[model samples]
Target: MGKNRDGGGKDDEIIRASDDLLTSLSKDPSIMQSIYALLPNQEKLQGARDRHRSLFHQVVDGAHDKEAELEAARNDLIAQMSLVNGMANLTGKHDPTIPQKLGLVHQTAGKRPSAAGLSVPENFRMAYDGRSIIVRGSAVKGARSYEIWVCESDPLTEASWRHHATSGKINRIEITGLTPGRLYYFRIRAVGASDTGPWSNFISMMAI
Candidate 1:
């Protein structure tokens, strides 16, 4: 009798361990659904399915928002790069001598006209010899040629406008047959194939 009772207790222990293992495995959907008739009600299973679906939607929406932010940042960077390139195209290479070359050089007091156009530099000067007005100036270093416009008054009216000379170089030019003691205005501009610089400061002189 004692041996039978010990054998029965050992079998009960083995059966309990096997039942625990099977119960753990039944948490998986494929295994649990195959044994659904022996498991809990439909409402509890549906609740678990709805929880997983909600979690999936949350992850997808979060990923979509992140992508949108990344796209916006990418577009902003592209626009900034384009703006930098445009400014670089406008500025060209850095040439330290360009500013000095473009600027006007001052004239000595005796050589400068007292009552003529104020702020006209000595390098861009017009003087009156007894026969004609002599206009003189230097061209920008890369300039191919220059154009000179000699007028009687300011550029506000067309009646006073006339092209005095167009020259490949900056040299002394004599304008003859002008009325003595008459005020005249002149403008000089430098040009190249790619660009025309701003007009040199204007100079005025009277034929004495």
Candidate 2:
């Protein structure tokens, strides 16, 4: 149980624990399907976990320009933790033993992390270069990382948006692999240690 001095828990230890849990869940899809009814889909949860693991190793290697990668990894891990915690809470209400069986602790009701002090990002701007969209925003206080979401659907509603990327850099975050000449709506939010801030006003642009 390696933990940091601040008690935030060690990234390596977390990755190890998460890997074990993911393996167990993956080995038995029936149990996972039942447990995930009130939680995020298994694929999304595992994808986030894998992204965190990959980025964690990159940071450990002392690679250059890894700060942003580290932040993104931390953000992804945080989201997964939140989802697991919620799942634990829901499962505990029905059967206390289930959480332990799944390698998760029962989260107390109404004990979600507070987002009170976190502020939404400001001065967000965007431009397109070839097939990439360059986004910039003013960093928020106490922000651990930033998340970018893009909506490609027309008559864009709230549910149409999907997470695009996460980064530590606020000055210039480039999002590539977009369809050329397609219209895209983008927005950003700041992720704090305990919670996330509200998303900024979304802006639209042509990817080309």
RMSD of each: 41.9, 20.2
For residue 56, model 1's alpha carbon misses the true position, in angstroms, by 81
Error in Å for residue 12 of model 1: 99
Backbone clash count, each prediction separately: 0, 0
lDDT digits (tens) for residues 1-208 of candidate 1: 1223322224454467667758888766577667555333446435544554555565567755455545544444433333333223223235423323433212222222222222222366565333356667754655677778766543334465687777777667666766774555567766666655555544555554
TM-score of 2: 0.44
Per-residue CA lDDT of candidate 2, range 79-191, in tens?
A: 56555544453456578775557654322222232356766677777754333567887778788899999876521246768998999878889888788645566778889
**C-alpha root-mean-square deviation, candidate 2:** 20.2
Given candidate 1, what's the lDDT at residue 106? 23
Per-model TM-score on C-alpha atoms: 0.36, 0.44
